[model samples]
Target: MSRKVIGIVMNGVTGRMGYRQHLVRSILAIREQGGLPLADGRTLWPEPILVGRNAHKLKEIAEQHGLEHWTTSLDEALAHPLAEIYFDAQVTTAREHAIRAAIAAGKHVYTEKPTAETLDSALELARLARDAGVCNGAVQDKLFLPGLLKLKRLVDSGFFGRILSVRGEFGYWVFEGDWQAAQRPSWNYRTQDGGGMILDMFPHWRYVLDNLIAPVQSVYAHTATHIPERVDEQGRTYPATADDAAYGIFELAGGVTAQINSSWAVRVDRDELVEFQIDGTHGSAVAGLRNCRFQHRAATPKPVWNPDLPATESFRSQWQQVPDNGEFDNGFKVQWELFLHHVASGTAYHWDLLEGAKGVQLAELGLRSAAEGRRLDVPELTL
Candidate 1:
């Protein structure tokens, strides 16, 4: 019976994740579905202003979508009549300035990860938002993932009773495109552009663990870049300065140790990549991005750790695929809907800016520990 129009000013909306995930899959998708359903038979529709620096490109996008609101100036967009929320998908290095400006303008925020470049800076942003008394959040998209959500279900249901440890293997060959077209963005391979595996992925893992598995207490890590050079679009070769691979071991608050292997160098092999192997004292589960299965030993398997002897037999065949829990949409859309709801009704969403900052903190410490060659204690933030 009532409609609340939450205006969202989205910065850096023309970039890859900004365009595909936030704009198309999340916002426009919500609009296409006639806005999100409300509890009392109402609906909330977001009035989104696409903000970017390129005038021609912004006009092209607006024309393509028949969107009336598009602007080249961030300040002008923020000053627009209907803009209420400020969303940023800008590069990590650019996050702090944009966020400060947004907070000063008295708008709520939702943005991509590595919320700021370092732990201290990220925490500051969180505090600033709180001081300004605005509902602040960051994109923790992994928690909305269907497979990971199923894994969380199994963990919550005591199916994996007394969890032991977690192992994550996430990678695919990201070609430098010297011989062919490059598979990933050139910024992802350059440190100066705020790119690296430790920064990029450990944030995702930190939240995933806290949400589904456990809270990380300490971390030890080492980072490497196997391929040190890449050719860009302009046929210029740049020395790779970011870590292409990261191996990290995290001890959870409950003492469950997790080893996460993230790489841009490894070739894809499995049905869909990004698998997590979660083991409990009574059972073990392996989850791919799209599929998850588990095996309950019912007891314990009697096996000796002998390299010479034949490895355990028929272990893989015992596990069964877990059925999908419910109808799922795009993970990004799930987060978007939750955010819109929070904006409308003030409902609590677990993955707020602080949680996102924790993710950034873990990443900051992971890389620091790698450089220092020692396990680092993660400090808790009050804000």
Candidate 2:
């Protein structure tokens, strides 16, 4: 079988998510597995040319992975004839310019979202890619999660007939950098550096709700900065100007409603860091990152509200676990492979730059809704 090696200009590998998920788990894992097989008895292999700001860190990463190509210059990396794809896992602020440059260089673009800091910029990127006739995509990794996959299966099978409402809880306490090192980077809490819970997470919520449930019609949100000050990496305290917590109620098409609360200040009390419970006419399901539990209308228990009576029913045990019918791969890796296939063989991919732009739009509107303290309608995006 013939083997095709596609060079990918991988930007922002020094960061945590970039380093661990995209670099090691997805791309390198594909290389380790002898490449992805194609329909024509061929193999599609990825050659990642590391690109980042820090030469020392890039060199260290390259050597650790036994890779040859490494460069700090985007122009130089894009100039390489073998580099057909440009992948960006950089911060939100740096993404738009890099993607624009990639589009100008006639390279297929794939990036972690929010694709741009604003809706206009995101749409501009989409328009540029379309005009350039280059393939583009944004990372929507949550859809491929095992729990979400099972939840999707139930949705597709009409398990939750005539879906009514969904409740989602997603967050964990990010240690304010004084007592202990924060799990996330400091930039995540800074507004000037493209930080905030709304900008960071509304994009994810957009795609998840749009794909899994229904299109979001309107949003009513309230946001706050629960933590006023936090220590930085260098042990200096800085004002946390960005909102750390956001409570949103989304009105979906067909009268479906979804209420999701995202916060970095809250401690976990559920089965997973992120979970969504979907309730419908026929049954209800609660899905986490890897597991989904369901309770049918017939099996659902009835309990009367009594302030004096002690609770006896084991409510948690009423729901049955959804069995893993098949092996589940890494969500990021799966999307990477799909995008690779799309680039290689002209495969139909719906999650393009336009889709990414929609996500940006959602975030913009969500922030506006929070500011106004009123519901805002989600307008349909074109081009």
Candidate 3:
């Protein structure tokens, strides 16, 4: 019945993802719910100290949230005596240094993925966090999605029975900023800003595959910059130097082959913007961000491949929708609560800096595979 206030140094809240998902939907939501309930009949209340390069934006967000602390100086925020955790959701290029500083300051760290631009730097961050003995974690929120959770349940129930393959389709057309305002930031299309489809998405695929299906063993990829130019927020034209699309084939540890296509130029044709279809010997399932449908081997439709005849059966109707047995909260919020609990009670958290480094490794190997036009084996990292 007592409450313990935990100060968290929240950096990069000015960015879109940082503002919406991590700050508003997760941390602030938890605060509105009377903090996170601990097992010892106490509440772990989170008080975030917003930090970023944009002093105006930081001040604005702090005022809007009715928060008392907002600072442009990371040093000042880190030096706060109550600051137990440092959370980063900044642009990829700016993440490593801030995290290093946080580790050196002896604060527990949590961050969004692509922990560093390269595998070496990412591993170094992991090593530093390990050596510092801080409770560190990287965001892997996709694993907490309702559809993926249901898919994991099916897998755990042996419904897949000798899983065979996975096919993932993720992307939607991002408008060229000149004609229509782009949904994503212009930095996402620039190579120098640590942006590209491979770097942005391969890390996600890494964790999803390793945790839900099997560990990735190798990868073959091809990437392209479909749009050559785009306008920035200031209405100035800039060359798009990063890949907008990436097609990859991954081999998993259990011999499962996963083919994924990520693109910003392709229009969405599926039920959701992102979907993964997993096939196994006994059954097959298609899972979107919110829904999952499955077809047993016996119920699968058989279609004739005659080009002359008209198709008669409804292929989509043959699958059964998976029932939602429980209410699902926001995935980001769920992870935030878990990480908070880990800090408060020494709970075991699997998605550590090492797991995040694996993601960076996948992205680096994927890019190399695309450049060399050859399959690259993913070597395990030790630290």
- Predicted candidate 1 versus true structure: per-residue lDDT over 165-199, tens digit per residue: 99999998888878887867888989999999999
TM-score of every model versus the real structure: 0.95, 0.99, 0.99
**Candidate 3 Cα errors over 4 Å, as ranges:** none
Number of the top-ranking candidate, with lDDT as the measure: 2
Candidate 3 CA-lDDT value: 0.95
N/CA/C clash count, model 3 = 0
Residue 279 Cα positional deviation in candidate 3, in Å, after optimal superposition: 0.6
Distance (Å) between predicted and true CA of 290, model 1?
2.1
Tens digits of lDDT, candidate 3, 20-120: 99999999999999999999999999999999998999999999999999899999999987899999999999999999999999999999998999999
Superior candidate under TM-score, 1 versus 2: 2
Give Cα distance to truth, residue 37, candidate 3, Å.
0.2
lDDT digits (tens) for residues 307-353 of candidate 2? 89899999999999999999999999999999999999999998999
lDDT of each: 0.87, 0.95, 0.95
